[model samples]
Target: MSDLAYSIVTRDLSLWYGEFQALRSVSFKARNGLITALIGPSGCGKTTLLRCFNRVNERYGNVTTTGEIRLLGKNIYDEDVSLIELRKSVGMVFQRPNPLPLTVYENIVFGLHIHSPARLNASALDEAVEQALTDVGLWMDLKDKQKSKATSLSLDQQQKLCIARLLPLKPEIILMDEPCSALDVEATRQVEELMLELAGRYTIIIVTHNMAQAKRVSHECAFMLMGELIEHSRTEDLFIRPLDKRTAEYIEGRFG
Candidate 1:
């Protein structure tokens, strides 16, 4: 049932936290193998929408959701859908680097240790660690530091390791919520470059308040306001020729 060209599609998706609505009938398609950015002012529900893809919002109390979310054409709301598998397919990275307090090798193979049906031997685990680190452009720097604690690395390296951990899960979609918000300019740039390198193989959706970062890294962008998606299009069109007044106003810094 997969839509070969699109990795995620949402139809009339709405969510409420107790009596407060967080997302209001958001509907859009994020193309396969591309980076899609969700941008809005703080508290505008960009992160809420991003969490929807993996159903992480359900962990918050008194939350309710309605409508449909499809991943590769399969409705994720279907009763048989597995939350564990859904999360594996849609990995997430947060605003700040949050590496596990374990060795780099342990961090990389942690998912496999927990999720793999068959117990993998040491060689398989080693290969997985190397590949994941290499994919995130960290193997050369950290290959000999396998026993080092992941949290001891620099902020940018820790962020890269956070991403590297996800790769071992073989995710199809990666979600980032203000991923570079905690890093300095050079660190942010390194993470951005890493994102660009990872794009073609996985569908990436990022929630960011930084419009310039959105312009720099995303292929497509969606603008939201007051829990509603205002506009979505190619990054250039959304920034240079926004069709919605709200989008234009936000882009122009008139109001957010």
Candidate 2:
């Protein structure tokens, strides 16, 4: 794909935690308005790379990163970049759903409260809540239950709530790190369907160990091994004909 077509581009990205190197000269791109899956074994840099997009890894102290990561043509590490704004543009969903203890309505409007310069009135907040939940296909189910505590909902619902919360922020990209790890098969399917629906409206990059899930949900796939990106291509192409032997082996169940 052309450079202009990508939402995220990384060049020689490397990271270290204390003395341990977690990523090594990794370079890849996630296309705009498509789902890209990062697949690799445990200890590989898939999660680390995902976190780099919004500079979330910096939260863990003693972390250091080198090279460049550009989002929408702007270098994320540039001095002028505001962390708050960057996070707003690039939202993230963790492995397990983490809903605030507030009501579903409150959770949906939480980001708006933080980012909006002026306080939104009741009607506006109601519209925002409805729109975000509708975008995530949760409006009908939760519309009447908006007053319910978010933590009281099912795990799948909570996860969807987590995703719905990001929508009100108008994020250009969404990063998911093993988002379905805590859910069952049926719940996983539901979330994947939601992901398909969310695609094209928001660029999504997911880190998953389930190769089948990657093939099923992503438009493109990147295979990583021991912190290095071995191969990246269309989902079908990479699965059928990987450019590197390591990628082929990992796909074939030979090794991670």
Candidate 3:
């Protein structure tokens, strides 16, 4: 049996961007300790759907959503829910690497110092930063650069640093949105490798426009079309023998 439990579960989750509907009451289970990939065309709501996992879409103006999203067995939409706690457990990585403007060392411990229950003493903060960096395979690269500004690193290094920063928060789930879109093939592969390596340690969900990359990095894949979830299946089955025509078409290089 799969050791995975559902990290996130949604019931009749739908969203509207003003008058235009983006998500259509889509419900699915995001298994813990595995990478689930969302693949779809532009404007098809892949990113919107991914944003819902961490309530990132709440920042949008005039956007509204209906239904319940359960994270770790609790309804996150409940009135008494703690947004900070929910967010801490579900970290998100954006399309572009967004590290803090402060020192690299500061960026990693920023969240812990700001929100975690434990006090951010000097030794604790140092240990947190070191552990976070080590988890992302970035500790050696950043060991000497801890005093340097976070923006001083290259794009790939910056992205890795962002991951290092997020890891210190000890999130149970990570949502990545087209993290490799701005990268070259080689750099993209590095991030992909990192994602796979981090899967069992943390549940991961990725939204990507690249079908091949989805197949490469994801254990399970969900394809979206015109605001609808066309199909979700194991990567091997979805690519080799799709049940939906639209999914097959997109996978076969026809139209997304």
Candidate 4:
């Protein structure tokens, strides 16, 4: 496939935190407009690798990284690359819902206010709020509640609102770190459905501990162990016929 078909690519990418190596020469390509799930046991570097894409892991002190990471074929570590623009292009959803303690409409347009080069007028802001909420299947429910505090919403709605907030920035990729970890089964299902609906429009890379969720929502799955990428393939193939013995063992209820 063409390089343009991949939204993110890592070549011999590795990361270290002080004396601890978190990722070990990991390399993979996540195709555009598809859901790619990173799965593994706890402390397996799944979240570390996901955070590396946006360079957010650098927030922690004593972090060191080597090798290349490319987004749309451009080396992200290039000195000329702007972190603000990189973050705008790559939105992330955390394990728990963390909406800004602002009104619903404000949350939706927050990204635009911060990232948009030109000041957006009231009408443009209004349109952005509507479109963003609509994109996340929340317009009908939250239209009349624009002024309502985002923190007042239920957990599921708050999570969806957090996702909606990223829309105005027009991100090319969405990184979700155990996005549904705090949700109930029904809410998890709804979020998964939303992910599927949004799949063809954005390249989504999710770090999920739930094996079933990996099978259900992702097109491709990558398994990691001790900071190493053990296997990556179609979700069906990864679950049913993993190429690596470790992957098969992990999926078959053996040691993590």
Off by over 4 Å in 3: 1-4, 116-119
Report per-prediction Cα RMSD to one decimal: 1.3, 1.7, 1.9, 1.5
Q: For every model shown, what is its TM-score relative to the native structure?
A: 0.97, 0.97, 0.96, 0.97
Per-residue lDDT of candidate 1, residues 1-256 (tens digit): 1338999999999999999999999997999999999998888899999999999999978999998999988899999999999998899999888998999999999989889788799998999999999999999999999999999999999999999999999999999999999999998999999999999989999999889999999999999999999999999999999999889999999876
Query: What TM-score would you give candidate 3 relative to the actual structure?
Result: 0.96
Clashes of 2: 0
Would you list the C-alpha lDDT of every candidate in the order shown? Answer: 0.93, 0.94, 0.87, 0.93
In model 1, what lDDT does residue 6 have? 92
Question: Residue-wise lDDT of candidate 4 within 1-256, one digit each (tens)?
Answer: 1238899999999899999999999998999999999999999999999999999999978899999999989899999999999999999999999999999998988898887678889998999899998888999999999999999999999999999999888889999999999999999999999999999888999999899999999999999999999999999999988899999999987976
Best by lDDT: 2
Tens digit per residue, CA lDDT, model 3, 1-256: 1354888888888999999999998887888899999998899888998888888788888889998888778888888887788788888888899988999998988888889566667988889888988888788888998999999888888887877777877889999999988788887888899999899989999999898899899999999887788898899999999999888899998986
Q: List the candidates ranked by lDDT, beginning with the highest.
A: 2, 4, 1, 3
Clashing residue pairs for model 1: none
Clashing pairs in 4: none
Q: For model 3, give the 10-residue run with minimal summed lDDT.
A: 1-10
lDDT (0-100) at residue 121 of candidate 2? 94
